[model samples]
Target: MKTDNSNIDDLREVLHWIRNLVTGRLKIHFSQIDDYLVENIAFSEETTGLASFAITHQPTFIEFAVLALSYVPHIQPDFFNKIIAEYLPDGGDFPEFGCVKGTNHRGILPTGETAQFIIAGDDIGKRIAVQRLFSSEHWFAKEHVLWLEQVREGEPAMSGRMIMNPEIVELLTLGTVSKPSFSIDFPAEHIETEMDWDDLVLPETTFRQIQEIEQWIACNETLINDWGMKKRIKPGYRALFYGPPGTGKTLTAMLLGKQTGNEVFRIDLSRVISKYIGETEKNLARLFDKAENKNWILFFDEADALFGKRTDIRDAHDKYANQEVAYLLQRVENYNGLVILASNQRSNIDNAFSRRFQNIIPFPMPRPEERLSIWKKTIPQQLPLDMDLDIENIALRYELSGAAILNIIQYCSIQLLADTAPFLTAEMLDAAVRREYIKEGRIT
Candidate 1:
């Protein structure tokens, strides 16, 4: 992974400044400290890596110092020790420096207090201002860039270790942030499809509504930012995609991202909705915090599990469940990008969420014509059908979803390979369709 030289230089300069500030404070060189406070760190204009990030955010000198401090441990493991060793050569504990040794790492890890000491020293007013950098209102926290970790119940907030978001660390170090994988911390999977819009067969009404969503993706920034509608309009677009299973709801969401050049993440509700009180919200917070500024499409599949209608307050569990719905509503409303909630039925969603949606699109089971279109598009050109096979009659007779059609095709293809058959006979097709009908508990 080749990093930009400019980013390396910028990081080196910030580290050097940290060293100078620490040395000046320890040596009681008040004039040097004053001079350093007045001088701003110069950064390169080259817009590729970490230098570009700094330039874009335009952080204050103190903020930049803290950002660099949080990142130093990851890159230069012994940075703080090297600085502290110069003064206290015997290496006694320096409480004012405010650092803790990691359990696995022998090197010193800077805490929020360490940031205060380097930037503010014994100055009480400056130290108070340093606390703002870690506050929730700060862009650092809002953007999931950097923050102080939570400490024990009784411990001071500043005593918590200074932590930078792992994605930010990767972005600065590798010049790109990799797409996050599905895990407990992030209960979402990156979803995409190679299939084009033309490949997706839908009823005319549903197709038009989908196109409207595409229009929003294309023109939303212009409406909010360029047209001066920021104050009047919500920053985000929320849509509800409700339909029966295997009816192209997920495919439409993926296509929206594909057509509009946005990344789509499907939240795994199974992992998100926890049995314990407040755990669900915590999981959601972790998800939303990471997704805050990134213009990614968030698709909540089978969302009724998390966004179901609030039940009447019968007990503590019921009350908390309602509260969770309320919290999710707030988060969804505030998200600046596209949020799509998918459900088997629209009525399953809470009225609170339903009212907030910009569009409520229904993906009904495909009509005969649409099913025929799907069939024509789905069958491989290389796999010839038997002369007696009537695909039109099959499409008209079976009330199947686009997904079910694909499944039937897959089953027939496998059977063809198994029997060393060159063509798909009506018998093979009928057997595959019957298998699908049986799976759905429908009479064959």
Candidate 2:
């Protein structure tokens, strides 16, 4: 079944009311003319139910819109034509000079230069009109559509409609709602992890770190709304996940996002880093600007490449690199949400950068018992195992990371699948282990 988007229709209904009210005002003001402007209500009953909704939600909004739209000719003439063309179709005519009426003008049309001049010209009258209309509803406190500047295409321009901000417009027209609205677009893969908290295999201390962060996320609202304001500490949480590849850094990030119910974005450092001066900051600012207010986690994987220790200022490149690092650190510190930075080498990250993080959890190579558990979990227990198969012995003998063990299992499983009696063999397992070591140049 298709979902009915009532927000769109409710908005159109409100537009109809504004069109009605504005046209009614036009008819009264221009009553001396023989052919007074009128509106054609071509919209279906299902689409535009009545003017009751706008009166309840935004009574002064339409009145202000009428006043604001008068300036549309000055700022957005093309947009104004697009709006009025609906009532006064391309064939319809509204004369440039006195007393000429549109043949198809069903309602009062604000299409003439006179209407534009009158609306734009009356500075004092407009002020009094604003005060008269919104005496009860404070105009300054309201989120009026006339003020917000949105990008028309690639450049910034004001979208002259209420509740039709760029984000909502994208949501209505396109399926996806663009975040931040700073960069033309963002390049980040949204990852959904299949691994849960229970599937993770790491040291007890590291697991405790995960628990602490999880509890913090769960109590984040309480901390901010209840405790954080009292203490004056920032609400954002920053953590560093450092270890060798395949020791569960990425999986932990994925699981954290899944657990928190907040959307996670993994930054692409390649795109963010630029050779030109100030371009890097511009891109970073755009990303962070969009990220603000939304409770989203930003995962910076392979972050050592960007947040590494500052080099001696022997050259311009070195100076800029340090500046880039400084810029990133400042943004992270100011951001009011969770940021997880993962790196293979903790030493590569500057002490200044490292100090900002609340937790610096180490993901060491899985110990023998943990490796045994990882091995067991990688394959289903229901799969037949040979009498010689021993995950514990394999775990003890080979100093393989959690990732390496999975790779070895995959290698042996594929080879066994082609055999007459498919089952794990000690010889096959040993061969796979040796192959993995050789592949990594550890046993070459």
Candidate 3:
């Protein structure tokens, strides 16, 4: 990544401010710390890079200090150590500094207590006020900027390590935020496609329903905010896409995001659902928290695994399962952007959840004409076809989904390439169709 010069200069100024504050506090004591902060901290409307973020958010002096302090270890690992060493020349423990050693990094890492110490120092009332910066009400926590890490039970909340959001860190350093990789912490995979709306073949009714979703994405912000309907209307748009596996449900989601210039993420249910009680909710919470305010379309493929029919309270396990559904339903409803839940059948999802959706779209098996369109669009025009091979007849004869037709075409293309055949023959297409039928457990 190319480093921005403005970002480097801004960060350098922040480092200089931090050094002066630390050294001044050590010499003049905590009484004069506020003066140091007030004199040093400033914001500019025209600033670029990380300073631009500060300008947009307009963070308070102490809040900006905490944010910058949390970022210091990432850029300058030995920042606090050098400051502490200057004050404590003997190199002994400085408990008042409120820092801990990282497992791998051989430098002092700042924690919530460090922020409190820097901004509040010995003033108990000031320290109490500083704690609010880490609270849920703060924009930092609400926006997923930076937060105090959770510590073990019974420990002081201030003692927990400060963690800056990795995406925010990247944006500050590299001047662009990259897509997050799928991991245990983030169970959603970024999904996109190069295919356009023209490539999709669907029934007119289904296509019209999809257009409604597109309209919602286009005009939702205007409806909610600009039109002053936020108080009366719900925050997000929820939709259910029900169809068989080979239908175009997933592809439609990718196209929606593509057309809207928003990212689409498919939640991995295997990684999300946990056998242990409460673990499932925790996993989902992490996913939702990261996705909050991101304007992402979250696609829950095979959503029945998490949003299935809630059973009667037959046992403790059943009770917990129902609770998980309720929690998921709440999150989906509250999400500000689009939430699409896909299932093979709408009946698989809980009726309670279904009642909450703004739209329920059925992606029924494509008709013979639609299948024919898919067949014609998918095949390469340059590839020679046998004069006797009737694509229209094949489309009419076989009941296939768009995805199934693509699979058959892919198979035929590979065979033609491998054999260096002059033309794609009827026999080759028939063989590929047979393979698809066998895979689907249908008699051929």
| lDDT for residue 416 in candidate 1, whole number 0-100 | 75
> Which pairs clash inside model 3?
none
Q: Please, what are the lDDT tens digits per residue for candidate 2 over residues 364-430?
A: 9888899888988887664567897887898888888878888987777677676744788787788
Best-first order by TM-score = 1, 3, 2
Q: Over the stretch 1-444, how does candidate 3's per-residue lDDT look in tens digits?
A: 335576677777778887776666666553434354436554232455676676678877788788888988888999988878766779887777789878999998999888888777788998988898899999988888988888999999889899999988887776668888999989999999999999998888999999999999889989998999999988889999999987999999999999999999999999999999999999999998888888999999999999999899999999999999989888888888899999999999999998889999999998889989999999998767999999999999999999999998888888778876878988888888999999898965
Best by TM-score: 1
lDDT score for candidate 3 against the true structure = 0.87
When summed lDDT is taken over every stretch of 10 residues in candidate 3, the lowest stretch is: 37-46
Query: What is the TM-score of candidate 3?
Result: 0.93
- Residue lDDT tens for model 1, 1-444: 337686677667767766766676666633433434435667554554677787779888888878878988888898878877877789676788889878898899989899888788888999998998888899998788988888999998998899899998887776778898999999999999999889998888898988888888888888888999999987789999999999999999999998888899999999999999999999999899878888899999999998989999999999999999999998999999999999999999999998899999999999999999999999988777999999999999999999999999988887777876889988889888999999988874
| Residue 77 error, candidate 2, Å | 13
**For residue 196, what is the lDDT in candidate 1?**
89
How much is 125 displaced in model 1, in angstroms? 3.0
TM values, all candidates: 0.94, 0.71, 0.93
RMSD of 2: 8.2
Backbone clashes, each candidate? 0, 8, 0
Error of 1 at 418 (Å): 2.7
